[model samples]
Target: MIHTTPHYHRIACLCTEAVETLYLLGAEELVAGISGFTVYPPEARQQKPKISGFSSGKLEKILAVEPDLVVGYSSLQSDILKEVAEAGVDILHFNHHSVDGVLRMVRVLGSLTGRRHAAELLCEQLEGQISAARLESAARDAAGLPRPLVYFEEWHDPIISGIGWVGELIALAGGRDAFAELAGHARAKQRIVADPQTVIDRQPDLMVGSWCGKRFRPETVLERDGWQDVPAVRNAERGHIIEIKSADILAPGPTLITRGLPQLQALIRQWHEDRAG
Candidate 1:
């Protein structure tokens, strides 16, 4: 007789995306603990032991879970990863920042948990969605439709631009990223819009704000000094300024395609329709 099971039977997900991925792979039972910030499946919060936050976690509580492996994302969680690693537990930290990187994360995570086949299937679905969105954008372009210039704000006070994957999503959704040059920077500080006037000068046709878990205030953008002439601000009444929740877009997982992409597509489509009408 031959026996085959996942290499890591007891896993602790310190990021919401990993928890969401495990659940999507039907391996939720393997999850020993999850981050307090998880909210995607909703049931995950209700069922799993909340063990950590994005940048902080108690070593004692994490150790109490006795996880065979712990998974997290980015350098933001490096401190937590260090504590868990010193305690003789295994840790996988991902630092993906682009659409391709996101898909690769799904593939790698699927392989780690013995769900390679499921992950492949999920990837195929996501790829198909990406292709479909691209096709839609191409068709619009073929008809000589102008793509909207989009300004995606990850934060407000410092005026941070969206990340790489987000800029990719904007292009896929038939829009041009207002700050495409800044998107390549892995750190938020690097992507900061140094002067508010820079955004005014960009004259974006759409402004989308995620605000990293904070409530996005379109009025604030509209009220910014000398922003009255910005197309997005001027068209605020037509819904050009919008908010996509952080959980859907900020998390580099399936939700980016499943939830975030669709919203961008709709907003861009509406922008075209409004212009046509």
Candidate 2:
């Protein structure tokens, strides 16, 4: 348990990650408000007033709550921060794009909320999980078993690769990302796959799609012209297309560490086992 927590008690968070982590670390008592998208800890919806959204917010609503600190993340929520700053409301914005970034973010949030010990414990647990996963995956790789080539689709129409954290998790899960370069990008736009043919050329052994919370339709992928030759598409009837829920793997928070990484590892391990047999 966090014995030494931060002093700022009236916290207003503009995203699910902050609220969920704060709540998880037993700092919920400090939260006076939360983002509209917060669905985890289901009771959070009942407890805190919602005041923000992607690229928009009711700054006055947030201000009315009398928050001492407004915690949020990403460039997407910057506009809201600017408005809050102008209104003289203190705000802290996190822009983490990698796996380590998420841990550091949680640590920082824990410290901010006076849950430093809890945050460090959580980070240590996450690092332990990561290390165990990497060691197991590395052992399998050393055995000369082919690591399945994975293509993670974050979007469909224009075809965007997964983010840095997702790419890092994919590697830890014993798969090679087909679009590793694009996955390095912190922004989604920068990860866009300009030519659809590039994906086709990579010929991924696994095609996982999570359309940023939108329902992913694997059938839509198979229907694409010229994608038939792609290994994942050619095996579509055999159900090669993997669907990870956005909440499971996309959120850059505790869920990603505790749930997302494990799920990805299971999928990749299953693929290897199937091929080995």
Candidate 3:
């Protein structure tokens, strides 16, 4: 029995990033199920039933809810999404890594979820923020402040560069990504910096590490062999270790700038001031 309502009810979000985006689009009331990892809004988890956990979930339970829409992300959830699709449930699969891709997703999701006006408004607001970031970067350049080389670490075990979205943030913040060439790679395995010497050779002026879902150990990084000689370490320009949600930065959702890019810009400005003085 298809409901005649324009908005979807009993929506199941497979990723927290999409969950956050739905909230931002003012469609929170339509969500009936959410991922267990959702933490940004704080109220979503408390209010919504935990229907899925990442890649594995009871498809029967999801079907029991009679959801009209299910949103999933990345290659990890491909199997689960396929199962949901086979069950006659509509699904939106998002795998974007770049900023523009996220904006496009916002517009698309907005239109699909009966929030077209909200989507347009959100895009305009985020693009405005992006424009401001560019203006700020230009202003700093006009002031003769040199842009520093930045290396953003996503994982410390094997060392990973910023993904597409994070790499975009690094550039918007007025610094050149030391590993910008690797930014658009789809997998973390591909983004790994296997050799310590490679990073040492880059001589980044700042190092910002966000060890996905874990606290980044800044002190541990400071003690690495030969790392002490790096300009960032020598000048004490090491940036703060932020605890960013992978979903927020990596997801093709509303948080690309609202929650991810602005914070990155603030960090870069701080690092620049530290190097100047």
Off by over 4 Å in 2: 237-239
Cα lDDT tens digits, model 2, 1-277, are: 5266476879998888888899888988898988887867789999988887756788888898899888878898888888888988788998888888888888888878778888888888989999999998999978988888989999997888999889889999888988998887888889999999899888999888999869999988888889999988887666578888887788788888788889888878777766767
Tens digits of per-residue lDDT for model 1, 33-63: 9999897789999989999988888889888
Better of 2 and 3 by TM-score: 2
lDDT of 1 at 249: 96
Q: Please, what is the TM-score per model?
A: 0.97, 0.95, 0.91
Local accuracy of candidate 3 as per-residue lDDT tens digits, 1-277: 2222346666888888777777888888888788887776789989888888876777987777678999888998999899999999999998888888878888876777788888788889999999999999999999999887877888988998888877778788898889998988988999999898898999987777777777677788888989987877776534433445565564556676877777778777887777677
What TM-score should be assigned to candidate 1? Answer: 0.97
* Clash count in backbone of candidate 2: 3
Order of models, best lDDT first:
1, 2, 3
Model 2 misses residue 133 by how many Å? 0.8
TM-score of candidate 3 relative to the true fold: 0.91
Cα lDDT over the full model 3: 0.80
